[model samples]
Target: MRPLPLSDEDHQMLLKHGKELSDHERRITDLNNKMTDTLKSVDESNKYLREQNNHILEAIIKGNEKNDTHKQEMEVINRQNLWKVVTIAIGSSSVIYLILQQLIHVIH
Candidate 1:
């Protein structure tokens, strides 16, 4: 079948629709570009947050290590204090015993 010739009004309508379609395409492309920019910004923000989180974790680990060292030192100090108390008690007993023996000898 032979193609029908398009009227002038039909040609005008085709041109208008084409222009609208082109406008729609432009809008769509602009929206796609903005979305891409937004996604990149979000990715950058996430990367920075991850780095900060890692830094915080490292600091916490270091703080824990320091606390453990302090605990060990405290334990050592406590052991030393215990030994000092025992030694003082033993030395006092020895002196008292010696004095009592001397006094009994003199009385006898």
Candidate 2:
């Protein structure tokens, strides 16, 4: 095995390289921390969005139920109104026929 002797310039070059590697490592660590923070923020935001979506879905369901109830009530009212109209028409027709019969008998 041969022992290698490093010259002054070579030592200086190695020092420069070492410093650059150290700086790069620090930068990598900083970037990793920033990425971790970003991921945490993203996760929190996703959770919040999920909660909001659930709330909105619940509101929609409740609104739909309310609308169904309203529709049913309206249908009941419409049926009652229809029956009232039919009854009134039948009564009015019977009264008019009686009046005409009486008038015809008097004429005869």
Could you tell me every candidate's TM-score relative to the true structure?
0.84, 0.83
Residue pairs in collision within model 1: none
Q: What TM-score does candidate 1 get on C-alpha atoms? A: 0.84
Task: Report residue 83 deviation for candidate 1 (angstroms).
Answer: 1.2
TM-score of 2: 0.83
For model 2, residues 67-107, the per-residue Cα lDDT tens digits are 99999999999999999999999999999999999999999
Please list the residue runs of candidate 2 whose C-alpha ends up more than 4 Å from where it truly belongs after superposition.
1-3, 103-108
Question: Could you give candidate 1's per-residue lDDT for residues 1-108 as a string of tens digits?
Answer: 998989999999999999999999999999999999999999999999999999999999999999999999999999999999999999999999999999999999
The lDDT of model 2 is 1.00
